[model samples]
Structure formats: structure tokens, C-alpha cells
Target: MNYTAEAPAVWDPAFADADDCLLSSDQCVIHGEHCFVKGLIEIPVIGSDEVFSWGVWVSLSRENFSRAADLWNRPGREDERPYFGWLTTDLPVYSPTTLNLKTNVHTRPVGERPYVELEPTDHPLAVEQRTGITPARVREIAAAVLHPGSGGHR
Candidate 1:
């Protein structure tokens, strides 16, 4: 299953016009200030090789953002150390909000999005990230995303 956010939660295109901001499929810079990158918060399926991914954005320091951009197209960039970032997308599926969670952005191959590893906290999302979830959980998530008003029912 997959869920995606178009931009960082704090992003308001009305305030910052196109010239002032730079937003691409994976990179973002708001008014030359806040920096963010789209990454995947992946949870492995319990009994299979499948994965559930949340396509979310993470805010990074200017230095980290620059480094990531620099290595964006470089081969073997996946070997670089993970970059520390703050989760910028608010995932409504879980409680206490998914915003501002600590994360380690692990760069992958040139074309793959970075893997966002949530900090080992007590939060449900983090817990699931650490421990694989069952197929039932994936089905439930799909239900929620597909029909929110029905309370996760088909």
C-alpha cells in the first residue's frame, strides 16, 4: 500500500510564488528558506517480501539538503551516511500526528527515493516501522485511505 503528500505540510504556494520556491518530484525549497525532500517511510509486510510505503516529505538542514542535492545524480551515493531530518508530512492515519518526528533519511540508488527510518519511539507509526505489520494491517490502511468517511470499511 502507498500514501503520498504533494508537498511539505508547511508549504503554502500562495505566500511564496514559483520564482521564490523550488519544488520538484523529490526536492523542495520554500522561498529559499525551508528545505525538504520526499522520501519513503517503508514498513515491511509480516509474512511476505512486500512493503507498505508512505511517500512523505522530511525537512532537512540547509547543509544536509545541499549535500543530498549534490549527490542526487551521483552513482554509489547510496553508500553515504544517513541524513538526520524532521518529518514534514502530517500522516492523519496515526495519532499524535506524524509531523516533526525524528528520521534518518537513507539515500538509495540514483533513481530511488530515500528511505526514511523513523526514530525508535513509542508512536504507533514508529513501532510498525520497527516491527513488520500483517497483511490485515495493510488492508486496513488501504481501506482508510480509500474511504476515510466510512471508517476504514469497503
Candidate 2:
């Protein structure tokens, strides 16, 4: 399941107008009226290397974006890592169907920007990674901090 190549290049201007764009401290870009943001995720596979999925983009409301930004920059927040948010976006290269997933956004020192880790939850993919992951049925959990609802799923 390992990525055959490096991650895809970041598309700077997701929207036509650069003036309305805002990049969060964690590197999520918000632009146009939809508050669009893009990031990547790693999906675990049993008895195999993890798969890296890129071009994972979602659209959030202005208020939700603001809330996420606040949590991203909140002081004394080092104790609380991996902010969670409900972002709906299709995994272009994988599943073309849009998924309403709870994503964990965190920064990894190895990369230039942050990585958005997907919480398996009850998704079918979780079952596939059972043996490859820890403690039988136990799933990797993150703090349920950001609860930005699905503004748009498609």
C-alpha cells in the first residue's frame, strides 16, 4: 500500500482570486466563498505499507474555518495535538465517492507542511487495517476538538 512515488505538488491557487485566500497556521488554504482547504492522509493496509492519499480537499463555512483557525493558533495548545474536523471530500485517486470523514490534522517534522490523518471510525477501510494496526479492535483516537459540521459533502 506504500505510495509508489512522492506526494503530489501543492496547487497554490485553488481558486481564481488570490485576494480572498487565507492560509492557516497549519497550512490549510481557504479561498473564495466556499472556504476550500486541501491536505493529505495515510491509509493503513493489513500486512502492507501505508498508502498516502493527496489532493484531499474540503469546503467549510466561513465560521467553521474561523473556528478551525482559532484552534490551530490557540496558546498552550501544544498539550493538545491533532485537531479533529469533519471534512467531506472525495478521495480522487482512491474512492471517487465523497466521504464524510472525521480527519485529524497534525504537523509532522519530516514534511514541510502538516498532514491530515483520517480517523477510520466505522468505515470499511478500518476493518482492512485491523491486523496492521494496534490492539485488535482499538482504533487510533485523537482529541474531539473541532466539530465543524459538513457544510457541503460533494
Listed in order, each prediction's TM-score against the native is 0.93, 0.44
Give me the candidate number with maximum lDDT: 1
Count residue pairs with overlapping backbones in model 2: 0
Candidate 1 steric clashes: 0
Model 1 clash pairs are none
Model 2 pairs in collision: none
Count clashes in each candidate, considering only residues at least 3 apart in sequence or on different chains. Answer: 0, 0
The digit string of per-residue lDDT tens for model 2 on 13-121 reads: 4443577655442334534445534555544544445442444544445665565556554555334466555454543232334365666655334323345665666
The positional error of residue 64 in candidate 1, measured at the CA in angstroms, is 0.5
The per-residue C-alpha lDDT of model 1 at residue 141 equals: 84
TM-score of 1: 0.93
